[model samples]
Target: MADRMRKPAEETKADLDKLFLEKSRVKETMSDVLAKLTANRPKDALQFIADYFQSTFEQSKRLDKCYRCIMMTHHSRPVYQQNIASAFDILNQSKLGKGLYGVTGSIFDELITLILQGTPESHIKKMTDRLSRRRYEAVTYHVFHYAVTILAVYKDYLRVAEDLFELLDVNSSGQVDKVYADLLLTQLSTTFDHFKKDCHSGIQAGISLSPDALHTTVSKVSRNATGKEFIDCKHFLELSADVYLSLLQPPD
Candidate 1:
């Protein structure tokens, strides 16, 4: 039976067609999940199957999330910075075309309303005013650069912590599993190195995490979270940042 199946399988059976219709990867996600299940070798596969969807993974593939992510990722690049300057140029012209000059508070507010969040409106107004000299506008590539710099990097710990949470929460479930706690440590390390390389942050690369340190943090959070059996990203990052930031060092 195995020999016969091998002869016809190529023609009769098919692998998962790579799903790429308008960024919807439901088919691909299921394929990966099923592949992991086989590797996991759960004793009661049926019960595992029953708990699969119920346990986690509802996607938060929002359009705004995508746009924000793209903008954030590329903001440090020269060409992207140029494009932003050009966009500011266009917006400035649009204001002038309306018999106004410089990027206005109202215009700046409208442009950023969709992409920027967790920032105070008052702070935003002050930013616009600062760039516009307490009055009229938002460009020159330098002015745009300064303003974009703020937009890109000015958030405090609490506000930008959501980005860390979203980074760790692979399924956008707002939490991560205890089983993958070690995995998150790996991800955190890689993310640090990636950011250092990508943003030229001068953090010194090749950062590594001590597994015991991460495990202790995970255990502490799991205790505090109580019965959730999962560590929410907020608690994990907040606590781990304290423990691990000191530990991070350039490879000697």
Candidate 2:
């Protein structure tokens, strides 16, 4: 009896690793819905869950058309890559971007340190390193597509992604300027601040922006040609998707 070992279950390292991967993926997939459900407290959560996934399924079909549209518009691999690189270039320049102010000394005001606010720095660096074969950095079409595929398999971020893109591309333009994106982010930050003031756990729940930050950001971005550069809608969508994905990671 002493020599013989009996356990209810036995899981080798491989089994445990596989289980962990699946568990992490499933949890990440359900995070948004779970957060929404908790916040809203629907009358029937079970039914709500079912409906959420169903709506997401329909959204996925439309999302597929988005990818198809991108591929079709480019028409060739080289063209697609060139455009993707251009967009990435815009983002790479903007991520650590320093806003300028009236020359007090040799230094610019540095109002906007990073446009991708609140995400892990490692993710931003990794993305930049990944796409940057040269001076510019961005998510390649293959990487973007694969990442989107992962999201689709998990929770279908397509709808959310689409909604964000349309909202950002105000004026219904096929592309949006970096300056405009800065303004939008500033507005979002302000709104979040307002909510934080009203709520108890505001710091944890909201992102805040100072009043002057907006004015300075606008001034700097508007003056720079790169800030005025128009990034393709699909490329912007990919950048935003990466931001959303990075937010899912637990802080180190």
Candidate 3:
């Protein structure tokens, strides 16, 4: 029976066509979600986003594709502006903000690596053209916030923080200097506060970092690096991925 029932060319073609259609449907659904996310009525968008994340199964497999779609859409002018504004507003305020917040660190890492790997200046210029100054800053803040929050809960936060300080130094300076040190502390503190407020309150207080402890760590790191020499981007990205994955770690 097996020998007599060999698969035909037509069957292979039909299977390929079906697979293509499935992928196309997924892309369209993602596009719709992206649109809703960046649109003016962010509350409705947030609900849809939360629902999508909740309903989706095997999220690990699709995460990269979803992240790429978001980045591509965010690079376009109209969608870029909308996302910048909505990201700041919705992501900074609502509980459903987790949907937007959870995915941005890796996306930011990807963007920074891609930019730095090439002519960074030209790529930065193009980014500036696509996004307004405020929006650009907001997006930057979100990325840092996401990265720091994830790292703070884990054992390697200091290492990753120091690496970031060096990368932003840009001058290949041995030390973190005052400005960048302050910037790192600020990002860490702000994101820590956010988690304390949003993630560690009411019924969801199962997983959180100690605000005072986080602040102390930030202060110590910042002060130690004030005059001390520091050592680094893809390495930081790998560290960022580690931190991001840690967020998904199940509570004991």
Candidate 4:
């Protein structure tokens, strides 16, 4: 009985050791990728990730690893983070749609998680500002919608929700108003549910929010707000940008 008990304990210890070793290896790989990106060799780093993803037999496992690698980039130096974001844009424009979807969607999801977990305000602002200047508005909007859904799904995020509203009400208006607020909330909620459903089974490309659609939504709301205060087009865009910035802050 003693021998049998000792064997089980030893197996448990070995399993934990194996887990730690795998984690360390992953960290090392991500570090290497970051080094290449920072050195202006983004193509090489992307190629390495592509090879790793291709070599992995399990799709889910490969995606999870890819996600971790991309998330790790967010914690890198600001310049490198900008490089990685630019690399993503280049990939999206090239024949690397698979990498773009896997990496970009994961990056957005991770940013939302970090913000909800209480990252610092300044860091988030800097990261989002960088991304916006790089013309990643679609990704930024997607992240904002995700963050709002998280606040909706988990009632515990009520405090964050208040802060988000304040940020969205760009002109310091008391509220987002009923019509425009409802429209924004409904659109975000629907997209969030669809994205969540897809993510449950596997990673999917993020849904891009078209500027035309946003403009139309704003137009309708503005016209409807003839007699009352409402979030206008300019203020709406500013609020969206601010929300994006808020979500980008580094974790505390």
Clashes in each model (backbone N, CA, C under 3 Å)? 3, 0, 0, 3
* TM-scores of all predicted structures: 0.35, 0.26, 0.23, 0.26
Q: On residues 178-208, what C-alpha lDDT tens digit does candidate 4 reach at each position? A: 4665566455444444544564421221222
Candidate 1 per-residue lDDT over residues 205-251, each given as its tens digit: 32223345445655555544443467776566554343334333322
Give the whole-model CA lDDT for all candidates, comma-separated.
Answer: 0.49, 0.44, 0.44, 0.45
Kindly list the per-residue Cα lDDT of model 2 for residues 1-252, writing each as its tens digit. 732554535436657877897744556448867976898798999997887677545443433433344334332244654543443333223221135211111011111112222434554454433322322233343544433223332222334444544655658877667666545444544444444346354443323233344446555666554644677655654555454444433212
Candidate 1 ranges beyond 4 A from true positions: 1-73, 96-100, 117-141, 153-199, 202-252
Q: In model 2, which regions exceed 4 Å deviation?
A: 1-24, 73-125, 128-252
Two-way lDDT contest, 1 vs 4, winner: 1
lDDT (Cα, tens digit) per residue for candidate 3, span 1-252: 874676798678878998897744567568756875777456676687877656443333344343343345423245654544443343333122444433333234433333233333433343323322332133455444343233224323444455556655667754545544554555544554555457544223212234444445555566455444332333333333333343342222
TM-score: model 2 vs. ground truth: 0.26
Candidate 3, run of 10 with poorest lDDT:
127-136
Best-fitting candidate, scored by lDDT: 1
User: lDDT of candidate 2?
Assistant: 0.44
- CA lDDT for candidate 3: 0.44
> Which pairs of residues clash in candidate 3, taking residues 3 or more apart in a chain or in different chains?
none
What's the distance in Å from true for residue 69, model 2?
Answer: 2.0
